[model samples]
Structure formats: C-alpha cells, structure tokens
Target: MKRTLVIGDIHGGLKGLQQVLKRAKISEKDKLIFVGDYVDGWSDNASTIDFLIKISEKNNCIFIRGNHDYLLHKYLTKNDTNPMWVNHGGASSIKSYEHISEEKKQRHILFLDHLKNYYIDSENRLFVHAGFTNQNGIGNEFNPDMVYWDRTLWEMVCVMDPSSSKNNELYPKRLKNYSEIFIGHTPTTRIGKSTPQNFANVWNVDTGAAFKGCISVMDIVTKDFWQSDPVWRLYPDEKGRN
Candidate 1:
C-alpha cells in the first residue's frame, strides 16, 4: 500500500538519505515529505539537493523550507554572508555549490526558493520544518519564521505532563487544528537519542544526520521509521559539522 514518508533534516548526507530510502523500500506511489534542512554540515550538500530534485521528478515529493534552507537561499540570491549561517554548516554548502555548474546552481536556488513553510496532508497531519503557533486552530494566522524556527512547541511538550490538568489549557492553545505534527529543526540527539521522538502529538524526526547521528524517515500513518548509517561514517575524510 502507498504511504507517506516524512523525512527528517538531511543536512547534506546523501549516502544517509539513500540508505534510508532504500531501507524504507519506497515505491513510486509513495508520497515523500522532507521536513527540511537538505543542505549544510555534510560534504555532499550539492549532491544531496541534486538527488532530491531528481527524485521529485519520479515520485510524489513535498519539500518544506528549513532554517538552513532559508539561509542558503538568502545567501544564493542576496549574497547573504551571515556568520551564524556560515558557522553553522552553511560553509560546507557553499563549498559544494562552488563545484557545481552555474546552471545547476540557479536551478538549486529556484528549488530552495519554492520551499513551503509547512504542509497539511489529507489526513490533517501537519508537516513543518519546526513548529507553528496557533491559539484557536488551523485557521489562526502563523508566523513563517516561527513555523521554521520555533522550539517552544516541543519544549512545552517535553516539560508539561501529558496527563496533567494543564493539558486542556496548553494543547488547544499551542497546537493548531492538526491530528499530528511532524517536525525536524531540533535534533533528537540533543535529548541524547538518535531516533524519532514523540511527545504531546508532536514527532521530532531529526536524528542529527548533520552531526554524529543518522538520517531518519518515518511513515506518517503507521509511525514506523527507518534510519541510515551514522552520518559521519558516510564521509570519514571530511570534518562534518565539527
């Protein structure tokens, strides 16, 4: 049966991405939703983007904009040389782009330019790079930056008791109208795990592929997931996000 595979932040781990897809045994009919951060950290940023673009041509793919992706797009289009972006893995992306053809670079820029901040599937699952603020529900206005950079949504879930009396006061106010929410920006590794985590109806799938962990992909419906080899192992010769 066809399934929706919501992928986590890739961070230029091409081999990791390939491995996860292979493990998932993805078919042409399956829908692929990438949470975000397709570039930076690893050495194969350009190749990773190329692979994603090529895969989109053959399968159902939805690319969501990540904070890294946004920074890269800004750099490409406006020559943004923000140190924070560069220090936080953007340099690797720049190096990768320098080796590619100008035409390909332009195409990549366009690809990044068109990324969506969030996506709501037919099942009402909200797929976003980070989190969105919604007091009332889905119809509430959201800040795009928050949608791609917020951590409070997950933070609240981590601290507040799911069974606490506060559940009614917090959940409805923080989460929008979505059955489930899948996000990537904050790696689960920070919490000392290299696997997807679940809390208060939110799933964090970024297993730190850009650093020492592996890339991850989750089945939106079944919640089953797959991972690649440790990301640093994929490129032993390079200092990945060290």
Candidate 2:
C-alpha cells in the first residue's frame, strides 16, 4: 500500500519537524501531506517555507492552507496591519523574515499562494487545514473561517457532541463524503486533550505545536502515529538554536 504521511501544524518548528520526519521514516515513495500553519510561532519560518517548497517540488507533497498561512499571505501581499496576526504567533513569523531579502520574501509569498485548501485521495480520506461541518455535507464549498479556524465543527464532528449549539447553519450537514477527514487549526487542548480518534470519521492532527503540545505525524495507510514532546520552550532563543 502506498503510505500517505499526514503531518500536523509545523508552526515554524523546522528542527522538531525534521526530527519527527526522521522518526516517521518518510521515504521518497511516500506521499507527504502537510496540515499547514507552516509559518509563525517558531524562529525558522523562512527556512520552513524553503524546506516545504523543496519537498513539494521534489515529490508528491500536498500543502493545505491554515489560518496563520492565510494571514501570512495577506501580510506579504497587501501589507495589511492585523493585530490579531501578531497576537496569534505572527510576531515570530515577522522576525523570521526580518533578515531575509525582499526577493526571498516574495518567493515565500508565491509559495503560500499556490497551496491548496484541501486534498482528497481515492482512499476516501480528506486532508484539510481545519475540518468540514458535520451539520453540512463534506461536499460543501470551502469557507475560509471553517477552513482555517473551525474548532466547533471539529468538535461536533470528531466527538459527535450534540450538546454544543451550532453557531453557523451555513456549515455542512455531516461528514458523509469521505471516510476520514484530517485537520489541524484549533489547538488540541481546545479540542479537549486527547489522542486522535475516529469520531464520525474525523481525525484532528493538530497537537498544538504552536502552544504547549506535541507535533504529530500519522501514516494513513498503516495507522502508525508519532509525536514529539511539547517543545514550546524551543522558541525562546529565536536564533534557531536548541
């Protein structure tokens, strides 16, 4: 079986991500899919983008756009002043590009623009940055907020919790299209601290790497999962040194 490796939010933790990939034993034949959030939170945003772009070019790698990625693209293109952007770990992303030339910045921006919102395979697995609404069908058109920051939808679908009120009736009716939906975005803590599960066939891989949690990678075919311990302190130096 062709192994499909789904990686969680990188959040610029290139070193940690490299170690995780090494541990996961990712091979050239394996299809690598990133759950997005490539920039911000960590010190190596520029290097992280460069690495992802190379992987995308060399092999079969799918990149999904996370909320942070959306914000970074906006900043790079329109130079928008979004305070929430900086608050949600965008400061580190800015710092990461401070030393880089304008040319490099443009390159990264272009790379982000090319990323897809989701990746669907023949095996009935849907790879998205966040997740689809269970109230709505998975075939529903992609909404930016739901695509980038829909934890409520994840909670509703992943846990099948009927207690929580549905905020947006605009969301999909249910997860009927795909057998499994992989997502990131909302921190796992917010998702209620627990390992990945198959509630309504929705799997959340965002182990909160940007906050106080691990970075996870799972092999879709083998169901093999690996994670790095919470490395929140890894960003204090800002020089990319451990």
What TM-score would every model get versus the actual structure? 0.94, 0.86
> Model 1, 87-154: lDDT tens per residue?
99999988988878889989998899889988888878888888866666434645557778888777
For candidate 2, lDDT tens digit of each residue in 1-242? 55889999888888778878888877788889998998787787889999988877766999998988989888888887599888777887877777889898889988988888788889878888876654455457565456676666676665555444335454344665666788888767665673444455677788777777778899886678988766565555553212
Indicate the worst ten consecutive residues by lDDT in candidate 2. Answer: 162-171
Clashing pairs in 2: 134-173, 134-174, 135-172, 135-173, 136-172, 136-173, 136-174, 137-172, 137-173
Clashes of 1: 0
Residue 138 lDDT in candidate 1: 34
